[model samples]
Target chain A: MAVLTDEQTMLRDMAREWAGNESPVGAWRKVRDAGEAAGFDAAAFGTMAEMGWTGIIIPEAQGGSDFGWLSLGLVIEELGKTMTASPLAASAAAASAILLGGSDEQKMAYLPRIASGELVATLAVDEGPRHDPANTAASVSDGKLSGTKAFVAEGDSAGLFVVAATDGLYLVEAGEGVSVSRRHAVDFRSHAEIVFDGARAAKLAEGGTGLLDAVLDRAAVLASAEMLGMAGQSFDTTLAYLKQRVQFGQVLATFQALQHRMATLFSEIELMRSAVEAGLTAIDRGGDTRAAASLAKAKANEVGHLMSRELIQLHGGIGMTDEYDAGFYLKRMRVLEQMWGNAAYHRERFARLSGF
Target chain B: MATLADPVAETAVDAFRDEVRAFLAANFPPSLKGKDNAMSAVEGPTAETPEQAAWRKAMGAKGWGVPTWPSAYGGGGLSREQAKILAEEMARAGAWNPIGGMGVMMFGPTLLEYGSEEQKLEHIPAIARGEVRWCQGYSEPNAGSDLANLQCFAEDRGDHYVVNGQKTWTSGGQWADKCFCLVRTDKNQKQGGITFLLIDMDSPGVEVKPIRMISGMSPFCETFFTDVKVPKTNRVGEEGQGWTIGKRLLQHERTNLSGGGSAFRMAGPSLADMAKHYAGVDGEGRIADAELRARIAKWEMDWRVFQLTALRVLAESKAVGGVSEVSSILKTVGTKLGQERAELIIEIRGMQGLGWEGEGYGEDELHSVRAWLFGKATTIYGGSTEVQNNVIAKRILGMLDHQ
Candidate 1:
């Protein structure tokens, strides 16, 4: 119910300007054609970082802007509009988890670098096929980490890693024992299979009292925010395409059928936005972040997946083709579909949280 | 997402709730107890006796016929939140609405917004007391979807307007005491040059013929107006501005129509309840097939979204001064949800859903099937979901006309 204020407006506008200038559809096409990932643009990430986006939600003490979650939600949404392949979303979310759950020294050590865009971080939570942090196959053994983490976004590119082990969070830097193998994913994001073969890791937060649970909860909220942005972009892009793409005696936009479809999709986007906002509000008000995060992630996963599929299906064959930018949004949507767990995972999480 | 934990409006709302509860408890007839009037698919006011009349008179005297409108205009003059409390209280008491039909649902609000002072004074009191029932005069043989292309003509005369038109799908037109109508005042213009006029049902050369449906219930009618005279004063708004007025009224109509199925709660066994009731013992307690249950779940989810979207609309209307373009989106989504939910209920009923003769199945399940079949109107009426998306695209999304 609290609408975006001035600071939120400014952050959103900045992201919009940056996206329009640096990660335009043409720029995305250029990157894609040059064999770069759809959302894996380092130059664009640098620009976003320069615009003070990476640290928008980080504290001022961490050499970052102290904007709220709503501001960060806006920035993520704008970046999602272009499906710009940058670890900006992952880095911000991972950094938020650390800043919120990490100790004071942990925050001081990692946050400043994250804020300055000197190091990028991605959470390696899914050690197995299932995206469950609690059911971790990857364990910490005597100050060393083993087992593999799949679908780690920017894992190959990231300099710092926030690994959620059985014990707690371990700060695993890019080193000899840690090998990052790039995983060719559907969304064309720079995903990786990070293998830790007895990798020496530093435990940032030990004596875990649901620290991994807390971090995963935060990750869900953060991923939901990013997905909120993705769905918004998908809705906008599809709407624009519907208007411009002419077919059979009238513009495809003229079809009432498609209009109705777009309207339904728009409603889904708003629902996702509301859920994400609710999670942010809960986090802001010091409410139960776990429940809110589950709700947000569940709502986002449902709407995000449905909207993305419909966005493509409604556009017909043209929506399926790679010539148009619709595919980019869909790609980002697929990546988000798996990021921080899918809809089913969140539904079960929500069920558990709600004591269903 | 603003915490309503200690919402500022709570005190007044709580007081209003108490007042409504006390009033309903005292006045609610024993005959109406456990009635669950809202659950009825074919909505007819349930209170039929003099006691019921007295109750209606008492509530209507306080302008509670429609609670949210201004008291001067024969409404309760309550804030929306207060009105919502009254509704919740009434709903809890199993009380039926004192008034019904197109007048209360669509026309009353329209008149309040666009009616002249004379029109308000003439119409509002009668409407509040349920003294006059109103019907819509918009759709024609060829003008169901493209309503603006209506051929209904009203020629200006010295002292009045002479209307000559045919309106079809006029629900409850056979029973209406009056009709608020749209007439093509100028043939030269398509959507423009139209006027909204009110005419007495008993006016000379006016006729209403009920159109019998497959359900054997004639909820709608075909009205033929041949030189039916309407007073100049009966016009709701300025000349050539009726199109705009009609459009706004339709927005209100969509709001009313979009909320159509929200009140549907069957007295005996909802589809889900019946599924639970008739399950396991029959075959592992799964009242319906897995596919059917899945479909039901999907529909239930759709219904939840529809309700949430409706609540969002109401919340926005309260937050902003007026309705947003998202109302159209709600209308579109809610109607589909209703249709889908009803269809699933019918599908879940299996062969019992097939009703041909009198009371073959239980009243609830049979009524559900009938309701499902009748729910086809969801897509067709108030403004097809098609037209709604056009509004969303052009007005809300700013995509259609951007080029």
Candidate 2:
């Protein structure tokens, strides 16, 4: 097992309890059945805020605990075990960008509300079909921003938008010239395509050039942590099914073929866990965050997808139906697999960072 | 990247690291730099040239050869962290650890745990000083995976035991000075009937024949003992208790085979460096071949992940005083990755990878082929991959027994 500090262990246990009791796979199923437009339970998000998770990475002066990225990642991982859909990941990412590049006045005005869950924010960086941080076509000219951003997670619910433009990162109010139309995502999460038609915006002090890359790398690490949680869940659930399900006059897990496959997946998941932990440690310790983040994300993307696919295959035909919880994990894994950057994208980025 | 939480210990370790770095810089032979010493080969101390002998003697005298062992036993008596620092410093200087063999990897550790005081005094110091070579005598013709099925027998004859058996795959048997053997003492019982004995390889009636491998090197041998006489005092533990001792020793062997103690070393140039030299870079400073670049990137990422996991497992074991069954996990994955790396090197070299000899191929290119061939045994030696899976399934996952 990976070593964890006392505080981290406490946070993990608390998050696990919350996910098991307050929000679980059944909760997501209920939300899906109710046809919720926000794609997640708002009341649960409020409960999370009350638990001080939304402020986990924010500064103490900003009404946060200042626990740092690793703590936040622990919480996210726990929630991911049940595929809990919330704005925590996106909002935390948006908060990180502000903390990294936001001016003091900007931080003072927005961070408190964000930490309190009174305002919802998310990064809108992707402007095209691909997951390219540098592919932004959005432009900021004379205090105004105009362009369309696709796959803006939690865009429909956000009150603040951290818009990435060619010039830099600009803060835009989610009112007036901002029109957010909810986009149907394969994962059934609340994602939107936002069109900014000359919206008045505030440019961060160090917003342009490399700011988006920095924020993306941080977000990628957090996202990989979530993927790790999901992959673990899928693996455990499959193993349970394998043990209980009997076929051909014996339990499925008794077969050497399935056991070998499960063992292989187990090893891959363990590897991913280490990579994700190292990434968070890198961010906390000021290491080569870009390369570490990319490494984690790439491994997580590959392993998460593989485990989910194996979960379905190993579970047999029942896994294909919406009635089984396995389908939800598969769907959620697909979205997370492509979020921030997919395996191929990060692999290329890792190569470039490594000077290949 | 995080600063050590314990500043005093950190400073001490830092000072130790500098001392080690300086010593290695002064003493490590420049001629031995970049030389492939066949560290994985289990063969006995081959007749070393004068330089190799001097280097080994220097390291042995400094007691840094086996840094973690007790100083009372001729070792450096360093902490695990200090040992890690020493290894890192040695790697940074492109110098290999001068002391390696079954003694350092398995026999010494086992003896430290199970051997009597007299035995420890006699053997551990010699091993620590790099003066003795040891070979394992666990498997026989009938007991490769079912190791307890071994038929080698030792009869108790008052003050001594007369042993007779054939042990196959006795690595370095042809040149080893000593053998840590497992022999049957009571044929009526299964695993309980075995005994662990330490015998001199030069004992009368002991014979060794090297077995050639596909790579054209014989790191292993077949040993036949015809009524070999061994003193009863040579036994490490009580008779009929070798099973437990043998299993424990294998844990150490598996850990060593998994590269747990050594710094990650590449047998040839790094994948990226090889790619750049063989496949020129594109205008964007990327490998010109897109597919090859992606493959190399994925392989490097996998290797990094494995390395990080190894470190995490080590740190966890150190903090909490127990080793996880993840050693099996490490062995399986580590060996597979090593093989994949070799395969990729061959792939990147194309036709140059196929050369067996001649000036057309660089030394690294030739080494790449041999390394690839030798790597196939890694998954098979310590424990076959299938056997590891069975262990993981039963021990870690709690899977049911099918048979």
Measured over the true interface residues after superposition, the C-alpha RMSD of each candidate is 4.8, 1.2
- Per-residue lDDT tens digits for candidate 2, residues B270-294, read 8888887788888977788989989
lDDT of 1 by residue, A122-203 (tens): 8888876557677777778888888789878788788888887777778888887898887777666677889998888777
TM-score of each: 0.81, 0.93
- Candidates' RMSD to native: 5.1, 3.2
Please tell me what DockQ candidate 2 reaches. 0.68
Off by over 4 Å in 2: B1-46, B58-63, B71-73, B76-97
- In candidate 2 chain B, what residue range of length 10 has the lowest lDDT sum? B36-45
**Alpha carbon lDDT at B28, candidate 2:** 87
Model 2 native-contact share: 0.77
How well is each residue in A244-353 modelled by candidate 2, as lDDT tens digits? Answer: 99888899888999889988998899999989999988888864589999999999999999998998999999999889999888888888888899999999899888
Cα deviation at A140, candidate 1, in Å, is 2.9
- How far out, in Å, is residue B180 in model 1? 1.5
Task: Report how far residue A6 has shifted in candidate 1, in Å.
Answer: 2.7
